[model samples]
Target: MASNVHSLSARRTAGKSAAMMPPSPPPENLELDGLDRLLGAIYEGPMESPPWQNASQLLRERLGAAHVTLMLRPPSQDGSGAMINTGPTQQQHVDSYESHFFAADPFVRLPEGEVFSAEELIGPQWLQSQYYREFLQPVGVRHLLGADIYTREGIECRLRVTRGPEALPFDAGDKSLLRRVLPHFKRAIQLHARLDFLECERALFAGTVNRMLLGMISFDQNGQLLETNQEARRILAERDGIWLSGNNLCIDSSQESRDFQRMLRQALSGGTHPRAGSEPELVEAIAVSRPSGRAKLGILVRAIPLGPWSESKQRPAVAVFLRDPEANAAQPSQELVRRLFGLTRMEAQLALLLTEGLTLDEAAEKMNVRRNTARTHLRSIFCKTGVTRQTMLVRLLLNSVLSLG
Candidate 1:
């Protein structure tokens, strides 16, 4: 078996070299125009949308591949792995591959930074494996180029391009292109995860809070209603000072209600301190005579920060969950380099240090970087980011960028 594998490797190398003969250059203007349109569509929104499909199709077209497949790791137990196929036989090939060959597939297990070649995997020795012979050969798959998609969560997905007998060997240019697009893919996947998580949490929270006897409402640090229990909505409806206006839970308060309003505002503005004592006291003091002879109303407010969700160090927004008192309070760029900007764990830590108002020298000391080298990295960051100053960069990240979510 070992000797057979070696022979297969030799054959694959020869085949790959033979296949490397250059093809005629594609129309640069036309290809660039198509790419621009495709990128625009991809950036516009959801993956399942028409624009996204168009972009994927265009990529396959431009790459001149026989098939393109985007597979997402299943999000839930019952969620079958996501497979978007652009060729007639691709879906069957993928289904068979997943069912039969995935476990023994060498390429799938490759490290995050490396790319895998189909020629290597499709070598004669690999074909000798019963699983590959019976499953893969039947499917007519001859080559594959797979790039890892690393997320803050971890390396959970991969993007694969496949070809058949007519397909050429994957080149360095293909690898570079894949690397360039990988970040965008990562961001889109992350955004999708965030929206899905938020929706699930909102549904669960709404159900749980609505069942509670106490009214509950949640807001972002900016006082925007992040969520509200049904009870909270009902209670707000009864009160003249607070009402639901479109999406916002509007609060009306007078001088007497100022303190409660202020506390709510502070909490909404990302203030971390608990207001339990202050809130109940203010609620009791503000209770007014109602026609029914019950005390008017009061509020209990608390600020909760959703901490980092993954190893990425991106912090989620602060959520202020509240129970109404008679009071109220208030408060409130980037392109590819900006949007695609990512750092390794170490780089992110360095960014955090810098954001904490550290001078390059100080940051280097803290991070144990030599001052000159620290200056070098800082320069790289600035040039890659187009930010002129550390202060501006830090400011950009202060509220928006987090090392993790």
Candidate 2:
């Protein structure tokens, strides 16, 4: 960890030193129209598959190079990093560079936002280096141009261009063009990072809701459906007690439907109704009976939060949460249960069945075991878990974090 920290610090220091240097003036012939097109491609990078494919391809063509590559993440000792290449280089060579040569290559950590050649950075000794001799030589690659980009988001990445041994070395024109576009590339990378973070957070919260077995449904001010999670979609599709009727929620019973609609209207009205001050009116709950006679579906309606000066149209201003009594809550696997309580396979199975509200006899019947054997497993489970009775054992397992797994 200390070595990793030092490496990052050194890289940042190099970037800072490079950034302190003033950039050269843009060339007179540099076409703004082409740059504008490239900028559009760059901004569209975050949404593209393989990210920045079109932009990078355009960049490669613009630079007139054989290959263009982006090291979105630099290689580390742990073998983590991404390298997207727009060349015909064989996959094996790419894999080899990522696995082995990345450490020895001296072309990295280029002056931040400043493009430079391998010859410029390494002087005359560039051709004699182990990385060049063993890897670059074998692949017939010679000329190299690279720039480092650093973003406010702490993202440090490198862009590299390579040409064949016979091709001319990258000149001032190539470097200048790359220098002009490096900032935009940095911004695109930052945007991609933020988008990735948000998607991860969304998935985490959605997964938690699913694990809790709650059916979440959101509605706009007009009581039109806005969003529904997987659980809510399942319940609605079944159409047991409550479902959709042309995007509007409908209850099976006429009286219950009227009550539900009244609550929705009151909630969507921003709580300005006559019953606003009453405790029961703040959050209304109803039990809708199902035609299948399984169990009543629990529904809770509440108003969405509003700002003092908020005035948005067709936005979510009501929330309806549904709970089906017959739906099974997520349970910990038998292996997880065994590991958590030091119980054997049979004991874990019995414990899980009990946690599901099953009697010892019913569990024994399901497991194809005698009732006495089930009782023995139960006693062992109780002793190991420090629970005196079956109910306490159930409570312990039910309250554990294993269910969230």
What local distance difference test score does each model get?
Answer: 0.60, 0.86
Q: What CA RMSD would you report for each candidate? A: 25.2, 16.0
Worst 10 residues of 2 by lDDT: 272-281
Clashes of each: 19, 0
| lDDT tens digits, residue span 1-405, model 1 | 999999999999999988997776679976677767766655653546422465567667767777766766722334456666676665666665566556656556445656667556456565566755676556666667887776777638767776676678778887776666666776776876776689799787566554443566655544555666666767667755656777564556455357656666565453343333433221212332234334455556655544333222122222324344333211101232234456444455566677666777888999887988777777777776678888877876654523212
**Model 2 lDDT tens row, 5-119:** 9999999999999999888657743677678889999999999989988998999888888888998998889866798889778989888988899998898777787789988
Error of 1 at 124 (Å): 3.6
**TM values, all candidates:** 0.43, 0.74
